[model samples]
Target: MQPTEGERRTRLTIGVVAARSGRLAKLGDPLTFVTEHLRRRLRHVVGQGGRYELELVSRDSRSDPEVARRVTEELIRHERADIIVTLAGTRVLPAVADVCEALATPCVTSAFPWQVHYFGRGATRTRPFSWTYHFCWGLDDIAAVFAEMWAVLGAERRVGCLWNDGPQGNWSRHRERGFLPAAAARGHFLVDPGGYREPATAFDDHITAFRDADVEIITSAATGADLARFRHQAARRGLRPRLITCSRWLAYPVDGTGADDPAEAKVASLVYWTPRHPYRSSFDGMPAADLAAAYERATGRQWLQPLGLAHALFEVAVHALATADDPTQARAVAAAIGRTRLETVAGPLDWTTGPVPNVATVRLAGGQWKRGTRHPHELAVVSNSHCPGLRLEADLEFLH
Candidate 1:
């Protein structure tokens, strides 16, 4: 039921944090798009019903931990946010989660896989965090998509993994906890040189380990800069794998953009949400293709995967806010978000049947980047075995 004009106005202040500047700023583009789309949806729905007014207090994580913590503190202490939403990965998400949990605030997040989130970081599945909620594909989905891509490309099953101590990297490198089992289930063994620390200035030891193991395939869950460095260093050290699939090199500030070497032309990664997806916006039912084209037209840049996922973030947030018995109450909003089963522009998100509570997921497809005429290179869906109905737009192609 819509809140009537006679009813009191709910001042729903939302806290939004994203890595808007710094080394990781590239991943924060979704913050801009999410803000725009959320406002549009709110305006469309606010007066028509849910008579509450929306106020967003956005903060830039700056891709730094201390910066993220400080900004979140400001939002909660000064701005008085009713709920919070986090974007991107690693340093920022954990900081926001920690603060929100401490304050007993409802914090919703997307764009990062769940395995690297709270429960994925070694928390037991039986123990559910009350204040935070996440919706994204995890290691299980990535492994399935990668295995399906490998089979489609007819690549060798012997795979090598390079990951860092960070969220995605930690999950990828931990043998029992992550990729090893996912690959092992598909009859592929992952040669892990263990997790490495960033800014280490060298990866020669890791490169040699993969080469020594005769690894025919390479997979990683490193940052964009690290992935590029890994590829460059691997080539110089003569560690050329038949196929290289990665977890985090699929979007802007990286991905196929500004990539000079042909080495980057052949790599592939999991596609959580792409312009080719058949999903649409929950608010106005805007199609994925139209959304991408419009984003490119507005931003004068390539449409990214984060754009869709970020849009989904707001979709989930808005739904939770509107459904809450008391939008002004943090506890009610948190519980409402945990009960999310909304269809988003990215895909269907159901938090009920989680590997852990307060976590939901979307289907993942495999995509490869290559030079094309339409743009720098079109990201064609190369594998969709795990994601039914998402047709394969191109066969897997690798550099020799």
Candidate 2:
């Protein structure tokens, strides 16, 4: 079936690399929902020359770096994707971005802190990346939000630092532009037990250090499994901290196992995106709450934080394609993406006004998971110091 001579259209391929399987597979669920919604709403976009048909090609990274690299290369070389987008963390985003950089494909990613995405990838200020651009909150933002939560709780300024010896860990404990500097500036003393590797089932050593320090707060960027294990072990060892504030893992269901897990009770985490957000989607003018409600109604699952980010990814990508001088030209599309200044479901994103080139930082709030009527667990925004624009839904509660 060929198009009539009067109806010729250019096809633009948008590639998506996500961790659709493995431990981090839950991260891809929201992406799937957003992609499907966009497919129905954005079948074709009017560009410079004529109407352009948009095709979205998604590949599962399997939460493996090597697999991410392979799938990304295949999308570019075989699928001829014009742009690549992902909502993965350090594990897959870096791998996808590396391939996009080498292949000269425009890429957009969120979910991971911008610092980890930029510096962790060996990107220096002088040698800023041209093909890859990232938009997300930074370590400083999370640290400030965590500190605010601790302040609101009026707990001891003592924090038990728990991080894996990965890129996120190194950055979390870095002397500059890390959590330590931010915490010190905010007058919080963090008891550093050093870094541990992931899938670490035992935390006896770290628990002893935190218990010995009499730390009241536990801050970590641990995997769900490791965090649960650490919490269980800490409890059994009678080392109960006043608060267990974490990042990354709590954005999804508790341990990715589901919301019913009792371990998630009163666990605080970074609130990247939630229905309480005041922003609306640029595509449909849907309020953040409405979008979240729709997702819940459609999936029969509780709204996760990535849902807003996943929607924003498409909003930014589609804007770039539609505004490009020539949608078929990768450089032109990349230029449009670089010049993006649009308000999305997550919030306003302006690549031009960045903390650093190739990165636009968003704000983060503090949230605590508690018993809910709508679901087994619900994240209530408890602290909004870093994101003052977002309204606070509840007061910070302690795990103890």
Candidate 3:
């Protein structure tokens, strides 16, 4: 049956998913966060514009590719989602990408760029087809930043890489192809003693291997809970090295309080970035907190990581819709997005080529865990290659 115009109002839904694994029990999941944020932002944008509607559907990928594909099919065919936002790293992104192409809908994702590349071939002639828009920083850019930081610190020699053996691990392995050779050319000894799992049942063997390598610098790609557990274990066993980790480390609240032992505090200085925190003081202005609070007020639970990404996703959707000449056409909306630049609470976001979106600049800063504060040593931007408007140090305050 063909539906009337009024009946189509509720058809626009957004789908979200998270891993349902025991390993991620402590750190809040990303799916929940994205869902709540999307709902909140949709309400705010709708209230002001009164155009489209937003719906949140939850799926559990368990990091499995098949599960991801099934969930995406359900969302597109059953839920009638106008747009889909999938949190990065789940097996679901590729599945959703394929479906979005078949359905001609747009899918915005927050995941490692390399994962997108590994999942399949190009969908778009101009960009990767399947109408996928990436919001996360690319691994190549991350590796380059790490290399730059190592050079600045004068600790470019004796580098060791460690990552969990999964999609992220596989991506890191590819990243090392470029990272190692770059470091080697700079007079550094790069070593891959193999990756380790987080919340690992055993670490004695991994610890022994790291010690034997006598590595001065270690780059880690781990989530908050995993990194915390590994750091705690490393501290307890006196396994200390200058550690460099991915930006995911900043996604969680990192107070030294999370560490059981006081000795862990000593190694905190080794963390890297542009020597400044990425978060802006204006984060308080971000609609995410307001949305989270509203969700709590109604549902009595706080939103988490994935929800944050969802909120950003919805904001992007709203921007695209507002600027779009015709919101109902998927191609038109995608065209608008390509032509527009979104000013988001996370920073100014725009899409570019590569397997993943390129981050023209990284807001670098560092922080330390201090009493009562989750982040100390607040981050300040040392450089931003992409953000031409933010070249001066004083202009960085605008990021807040």
All candidates: TM-score: 0.91, 0.93, 0.68
TM-score of model number 1: 0.91
Task: Give the alpha carbon lDDT tens digit for every residue of 1-400 in model 1.
Answer: 3347667655777888978888767678767766765665565224223667777778888888888888888888788777888785676788888888888888888777787785564456777788988888888788888887776645447788887766677776556757668778888777787778985567888898898898878887766667777877888888877788887777653434444432354778878777778898887798888888888888888888888887877788878888887776789888888888887788888988877788898788888876666666667788887677788887787767
CA RMSD of each candidate after superposition = 3.6, 3.1, 6.7
Q: For every model in order, what is the number of clashing pairs?
A: 0, 0, 23
The pairs that clash in candidate 2 are: none
Tell me which of candidates 2 and 3 scores higher on lDDT: 2
Against the hidden true structure, what lDDT does model 3 obtain?
0.51
Off by over 4 Å in 1: 1-9, 44-50, 120-122, 153-156, 253-265
Error of 2 at 334 (Å): 1.7
**Candidate order by TM-score, highest to lowest?**
2, 1, 3
Model 3 lDDT tens row, 67-147:
767777777677766566665453456666666667777777654444334333343334545365666544555555555
